[model samples]
Target: MRFSVNKSEKYTVLVPEEEKLDSLKAPQLKAEIVTMFQSGTENLIIDLSSVKYVDSSGLSSILVANRLSTEVNGKLVLAGLNEHVMKLIKISKLESVLELHPTVQEAIEAIFLHEIEKDIEGEED
Candidate 1:
C-alpha cells in the first residue's frame, strides 16, 4: 500500500514501495488504480523496481489496471520488474497481455508513442 505517485498530464507513475506485493497489499493497489482511473487518469505506469515478490493477487491487481486502461482507450505499462517478478508474470502467461519496459523512462516513451498512434488513427478516420 505504501507507494509514491508522480502525476503528469498524459500519465501517472505509481511506484509501490513494498518488497512483496501479496494479498495484503494487492487490495490497496487495486483500489488505488481504480481511483486513479475514476479521476480521469487514462494512462498508467507501474514501476515495480522495488518489488521483488508477487503473488496471484498482485498480478490480479495489475490486470485490473490493464482492463481499466483498455476501457479508456489508454495504456497500462509495467516497468522495472525484477527477475523473479518477471518470471512469475511470464509463468502466468501475462507477458503477452501486458506492456513491459526496462525503466520508467522507457515506459513513458511507450505511452507517448501509443498516444501518437491513437491520434494518427483518429485522424485517419
Candidate 2:
C-alpha cells in the first residue's frame, strides 16, 4: 500500500491511495500499519477516497491499523469509501469495527471530537 501523511496540530492523516492487490505480504501491510501508528501521530484519519476494492486481506490490514490506533489512544477514521468498498466492509461486518465518514472534513472533525470526548471521559473518571 502507498500512503501520504499530513500532520496538523490536532491529528495525523494517512491518505492510502492504492493497496497491494495480492494477498501476499498482508503481514507486511500490517507491519506498515503499526509503523504508521508509531510514527508519533496522535489521532489518525485514513482517507480511502482513492481506494477502489479491498479484499479480505486488505480488511485485515485495516483492522490491524484500527487496533494499533486504539492501543495508543488515537482515532482511526476512514473517509470517502466507494460503493463497492462500502459493500465489502458491510459484508465483512467491519463497519461496526470502523468509523465511516462521508467526507474528509467530517472524518477529521469526528476524530478530533472523539479524542476530546475520550479526554473528557478520562477526566471524569
Candidate 3:
C-alpha cells in the first residue's frame, strides 16, 4: 500500500512502491483512488514501474479506478507496467479496456490530449 502521489492541476500520478500488488495491497490502492476522485481529481495516471507482480485483486482495483474515471468522463491511464504485468493484463483481455502507456510522461500527454478533445466537443455544443 505504500505509494507516492504527485498532483498537478491537470492530473495526478500515483506510483505504488510495492513490488507485489496482491489482495493485501489492492484494497488500499482502491481506497486511495476513491479518495482522489472524491476530492475532485478527475484525471489519473498510475505509474506501475516498481510493481513486478499483480494478482486478480490488483486488477480489480485498477478496474475500479477505470470505472470511476469513466463515470466522471475523465481518464485513467496505467503507465510503466513491466512485461509480466502487461502479459497478465493481456491474458485477462483488459489491454483494450485499460489505457496503457510505456511512460508517465506519455500518459500525462494523453490526459492532456483527452482534455483537449473534451474541450473541442464542448465547443461544438
Candidate 4:
C-alpha cells in the first residue's frame, strides 16, 4: 500500500489509499512507519479509513510502528477503523496498547492532548 504523509502537531499521518492491507504490503507499510519514526517526529498516526482489509501481517505492521514510537517516547495512533477491522483489533486485544480515534482529525487532537497531558504531569512534579 502506498501512502502520503501529512505532519501535524508534531505527528506524522500515514494516509494510505489502498483497498487492502495484508501480508504482501505489510513490510512496506512497516518500513514507511519506521521511516516516519526515524524522522524525529514526536508522534505517528496511521489513517486506516481507506483500508478495507487487514490480515495478521498488517496487524504486525501496526505493532512495529507502536514499538518504534515507544522507543522514542513518541506515540503511534490509529484512526477511522471500519467495524470489521475494529472487530479484528478487539479480538487481538491490541486496542489497549494502541489508541484509536474515530477520525484523522480526532487522532491529531488526541496526540496533541496526550503531549499536553504529559507536559502537565511533568510540570506538576
Clashing residue pairs in candidate 2 (N, C-alpha, C atoms within 3 angstroms): none
After the best TM-score superposition of candidate 3, give how far the Cα of residue 102 lies from its true spot, in angstroms.
0.5
Superposed by TM-score, candidate 1 places the C-alpha of residue 24 at a distance from the truth, in angstroms, of 0.4
lDDT of each: 0.98, 0.79, 0.97, 0.87
- Candidate 3 residues lying further than 4 Å off, grouped into runs, are none
Global CA lDDT of candidate 1, please? Answer: 0.98
| Models ranked on lDDT | 1, 3, 4, 2
lDDT of 2 by residue, 1-125 (tens): 56677889778777775743237645666676687677776677777788777788878887877888788888888888899889998988889899999999999889879878988999999
Question: Model 3 residue 3 lDDT?
Answer: 99
CA lDDT for candidate 4: 0.87
Worst 10 residues of 2 by lDDT: 19-28
Clashes of 2: 0
Q: Of the candidates numbered 3 and 4, which has the greater TM-score value?
A: 3
Q: Candidate 2: where are CA atoms >4 Å away? A: 19-29
Tens-digit lDDT string for candidate 3 (2-111): 99999999999999999999999999999999999999989999999999999999999999999999999999999999999999999999999999999999999999
* Better candidate number, 1 or 2, judged by lDDT: 1
Among residues 3 or more apart in sequence or in different chains, the pairs in candidate 1 whose N, CA or C atoms overlap within 3 Å are none
Which prediction has the highest lDDT against the true structure? 1
Candidate 1: list runs displaced more than 4 Å: none
